[model samples]
Target: MRTAYRVETVRAAEAALMARLPDGALMQRAAAGLAGACATILGRVYGARVVVLAGSGDNGGDALYAGARLARRGAGVSAVLLGARAHEGGLAALTRAGGRVADDPFAVLARADLVLDGITGIGGRGGLRPDAVPVVRAARGSDAVVVAVDLPSGVAADTGAVDGEAVRADATVTFGAYKPGLLVDPAREYAGAVRLVDIGLGPHLPSVPELEALQHADVARLLPVPRVESDKYRRGVVGVVAGSARYPGAAVLAVAGALRGGAGAVRYVGPAGQAVLARYPETLVHAGPPGRAGRVQAWAIGPGLGDTPGVDEVLESDVPVLVDADGLRLLDPAAVRARTAPTLLTPHAGEAAALLGVARDDVEARRLDAVRELAARYGATVLLKGSTTLVADPRGDLPVRVNPTGTGWLATAGSGDVLSGLAGSLLAAGLAARDAASAAAYLHGLAARRAARGAPVAAHDVADALPGAWRDVIG
Candidate 1:
């Protein structure tokens, strides 16, 4: 798992590390890494025009020190100081290495090959400060390849919220570990590409992280593979309650995903049985209420079930349940809170906004807060789907899972239905609610990227690619 820590935690860790190290040792280590990254980006540092945007804080010091290193290697470096006071030691070092403070910030920025953004650090609360706004704008507008020092100037490091205008960097060279903002959006969008440079933060940090992303090894461990003695009855069965007369395609897509989600059997109950059977003839179809849909290890409710007639019945069952789409609309919070088994709720921004009685824009803006709030309120594992898919648990002991694999092309209809079925199947296969949700999201996004392949893809294409995605991960 790739983990991220909160600002306070990071600060404490840095302080602890600094206490053990020699005077100015940590900064030099950071500067060396930053300079190396800049040199790599510039290809040949010799005579390369490098511009550093320096502010008042340690971020500016880092940039200046890095600039000094680059200057010594024959790069023509200039510092466009935005703060009232500069790092005196860093300034002297840069001067000694043949770099100068820029007489014209804009002029130097306009023709620079690379621009290092040291305008703000993790401690910064809001957008760019007023004095540094013009300098940031000039750097952004320039042809220079912009690289943020730790994070983009205007993004919240812990919340991933952008209050106002922020620096949009081509790449971000982060120190130590990943921040929540770098993994989520709208801050994630600002940080184009992220590279982590370890500065020995691991020993100083705690075990529990604020956020985490599951990689292939993690997902593979969570997935259930068939055993020699395993049979259909032992492998687990997933019951899907979805679709209506008005939208039969939802059932088909849901069943399609469930079929490949490591579940040995899929029992579908809804008005769209004919549609489901037409697509997946192997599916066990039932045209009655979900109560009589035979025994199932887990249940996935509401994709296209317009009125959600049997939602209560499924929610009352002892088995784990996944609620999504129209089912989320008819849900009773009290009933969800009363459930004994695990419940996972999947909601897009609009649905989540409605549940929290807030604007969709608000939910979209603060996805981490929204997901946590919903998970607490509903007493269930909440998966907020968007550009960055987040899975939050109410217990709050585990770090919120951020899905790393996905493409913009996944913004298509019926994708959520596929995800619901897949996650529900994983739940039936005996993974914990958080693990099921995270693993399902990982595979779903990977499948979407595989199916799309830089082209427009339908929802069924993503469902069909699940096996390939699973194979890729396990391989």
Candidate 2:
């Protein structure tokens, strides 16, 4: 798992580690790692034109010191100080190593092979300073590969919010630990590729992280595997209430996802029973209300359930439930809060915006906050689906899980319906709500990537690719 800490916690950890080490030792270690990364990016450092954008902060110092190291390695390094004053010690070292302060920042930036952005640290809130905007823009317009120091300037480290002008890096070299901003969206979009530099701050940091992204091994551990003695019922039965007279395809797609989600048997109830049976004869079909559906370990409601009246019945069940699509529109916060069993709500940006009574743009801008708020309000685990799927628990104590695997090709009709069924199946298998949501998202995104492979893919293609993704994880 890739874990991220808040800025305050990271700052406290850094301070504790710095106290134990000798003066300037920590900064030097950071500079060494930064320089090594820069050198690696610029394969042949000899005569390479490197430009450093330094601000009046420790981030600037790290960049300046790194510039000195590159200068010693035969790279022609120049510094453009953007702040009122730069790090005095770092500036001196750069000059000693044959690096010069650039007289024309724009002229140097235009010709540079690589640009190091240290214009603002993680603490920077609103955006870049007025004076630094043009210089940052010039660096961006250049053909140079821009690398941000610690974090891209102008993004909130805690919330991943970008209020104004921000640096868009080709890659970011963050030290010690990953910031929440580096993992969450809006800010995550600004940070291209991220490389973590270890400065030995691990021992000093807290055990619990603010955010986490599951890797293949982590998902493998969470996935439910069948035993020799296990029967269909023992494996887990997922009850799916989806589809309608107008849109029967949603039921077929949702049931497809459920079947691939490791469930033993799927009992689908709705008007689209004939369509579902045509696609998947294995499914146990029912005509009316989901309450009459035999026994199920979990219930997956919503999808193409236009004006369907099963949300209340499913919510009343003791088993875990997953609500999505049209069901989210008919959700009652009071009913969700009243449930004893766990409930997972899956909502896209537009759906989420409607639930919270805010603009879709607002939810897109502050995904982390929106998910957390919705989870708290409904007293249920909420999965906000998008380019980066986020799962937030209602208690707000556990770290929000971020799905790292995905492609833009996932933005298609009925894709979310598939996710709803997959997550619902995981819930039926007895995984905790948070684990179920996160694991489903991980698999969903991986399957989409496998199915698309740089081409367009339909929702069923993603569902079809689930087994391959499952094998890849547990293999």
Compute the lDDT for candidate 1: 0.92
Model 1 over residues 1-475: C-alpha lDDT tens digits?
A: 8999999999999999999999888888888999999999999999899999988888888999999999999999999988888988788899999999999988999899999998887878889888788888888888889999989988999999999878999999989889999999889999988888899999988899999999999999999998999988688999999999999999999998899898889999999998898889999999879989899999999999998598899999999999999999978899999999999999999999999999999998999999999999999999999999999998978799999998899899999999999999998888888999999999999999999999999999999999999999999
lDDT (tens digit, per residue) of candidate 2 on 310-345? 999999999999999999998999999999999999
Residue runs of model 2 more than 4 Å from their true location after superposition: none
lDDT for every model? 0.92, 0.94
lDDT value, residue 169 of candidate 1:
95
* Clashes by residue pair, model 1: none
Task: Kindly provide the TM-score of model 2 when superposed on the true structure, using C-alpha atoms.
Answer: 0.99
Which run of 10 residues does model 1 get worst, by summed lDDT?
119-128
| Model 2, C-alpha of 120: deviation from truth (Å) | 0.5
